[model samples]
Target: MPTTLPVGDVTSNGRTWRQSYAEDFTKPAALGTVASVYPGMGLYDGFQDTSGLGTYAPAKVLSVADGNLDFDFHSEDGRPLVAAVMPDGYAPHTTARVSIRYKTTVTDGYKFVGMLWPSSDEWNDGEIDWPESLTLGASPRPASAIPGTYANRHVKYDRSVQVHAKTDTTEYHVATTEWDTGIVRFYWDGELVSCTTEAVPTKPMRVTLQGETWTDHGAVPTDASGTVSVDWISIWN
Candidate 1:
């Protein structure tokens, strides 16, 4: 049930964007959280495995590159990339619009997969798994396709990931999503790429980024220290 509420620019409840939504990453808290980290200079936090939620797993740190404090995660200790949703809480019957900017460096199948996983689990904060709305997608056959059971399925949220291949040093680009009930829409560089309404997730969620090994692309995240980096991330409720 997509609500008729109005949404705003930056951050909003439906019609208005919240000021905090467009916040710039700064010192200290800028790094977000690291599981086992070491803060230095512009990077305030370090990978502190024992530190818990606020910290990401796999002794990683937020480093500055290309005039931005981007996060580089490519290690066994590095936890699954995830973001936190403020206590403000998202509204019901409204759409959750999220946008993110990042760059990847890959070489093979290490599928550069980014998602909105529940920070609690990815960061080892709690036992609850992050609800997959746009990440999971819907589970019904599309009307446009021939009406019949087929091994090939059509999901409401058919999301595709981007890769920044190891050492490619190219800005894979930013993307946005609109989660409305059973539907999940995707946009890259402000252009709509997909619109799905399949296995829709209904719950509070967070942002996530990942680059795991994959054979489909015949690439894998090199076993290096820094393989992927993130420039900026935000969500418009």
Candidate 2:
């Protein structure tokens, strides 16, 4: 996601939070964030690293029909690929919410959509990883790798509330992370899934959504490609 002001405004709790950035992928030119694609993994506020071992293809806006646009993230060589956007400003220390609606085509790879501190070296710094999963069940897998299970996490001060909850990934689901001074909560389809207060982030962070062919060791065998679709994303503070 781009680091700039959103194009619209949303009012919540008597306070108005602007739409720092949004993409339906209806028009590529209209996309506000930097795009992270193959060969080059830098853009859209994403980190740049070596390619092939585990890299991402650039995010594209596919047109399904007239006036209908959807954001697409796919990998050509079965490598990791991602399409992400960052919000314009720091989240309010008092309260804030970051939410997105998305779905995947296959269960062979890893897909993570959530929030994290932009500059933190470790993911445990004030992070909210909802709808985060390792579906393929790596060779030396974690207990959460069951077919019908999904891993959702909340991190603060390096401590995390990592839980495996049963869910269907083929269908679209709404995932959100809400936080304030007391605690951070994870939600799926409007229901609370997990909550933690240990390592809640205090600094500002950015939103990231990525789809990759991965495992505990390396890339796993799967289709030549996979995709993750985003219907919409919103933030309030």
Candidate 3:
């Protein structure tokens, strides 16, 4: 893969996109210290208290080597281990595009999610998840959620309009999400797989790459382990 970022502006769907952030992971480092490794990104570490799942131990679960950012997930003390990371400063964009070239080892009890999370940190605003799937036995899909009133309480309603990709996680693929006014599109290998106007987020959002146990789909086996490698990532606005 090319170690350098794409040189000029990228034109897609008649829109000119200027690259805002890019990472090739050519310099070897640990993602746990992302501030020093990649300057404009932050790592989610420490025991996760709210999610009721495994710990986010970046040092143990994430690294950079061989020109890729790698996520190594395993069971620790019967609890799942995982990592999450995102870019800082240049985020919370009302309209943006993100593309990630990545592949993974297909393990039974692990999953990955690439998402645009609301900058407001409120579920009521919106969320966009793309290239999300279990590490095994599933294809990548684009999903979205919006908050609404339920039983006199505000709750998120997952309006995941399924846009499936035929590719599996073991093969390298470029997953892209384009967010514009009143619309969101998901593409796999430059082919538009899904588009949705429902619950399109209008507020600024930030990109997050998260790897976690597939608890929502099934119970994680005690011996589950896997690796997810991101060859590179580019953001445009």
| TM-scores for every predicted model | 0.49, 0.62, 0.88
Cα deviation at 232, candidate 1, in Å, is 1.3
List residue ranges in candidate 3 displaced over 4 A: 1-7, 30-35, 49-51, 88-90, 147-160
Best-fitting candidate, measured by TM-score?
3
**Stretches of model 1 off by over 4 angstroms after superposition:** 1-20, 26-58, 65-69, 73-95, 118-169, 211-226
Tens-digit lDDT track of model 2 for 66-176? 222233434455544544444333333335666666666554645444454434434434355566666422111001111112235422232235655456556666676
lDDT per residue (tens digit) for residues 61-144 in model 1:
344444344544444444333222221232222345665555554333233333443333322211111111111111111111
Ten residues in a row with the worst lDDT in model 2?
Answer: 139-148
In terms of lDDT, the poorest run of 10 residues in model 1 is: 138-147
Query: How would you encode candidate 3's per-residue C-alpha lDDT over 1-237 as one tens digit per residue?
Result: 333455456787778988788878888886455557776776777866224567788878888889889888987788888888895543668788888888888788878888898888877778888889855436888887763322344555445568679877788888889987778888988889888877688888889998877755556788878898898888888
- List the candidates ranked by TM-score, beginning with the highest: 3, 2, 1
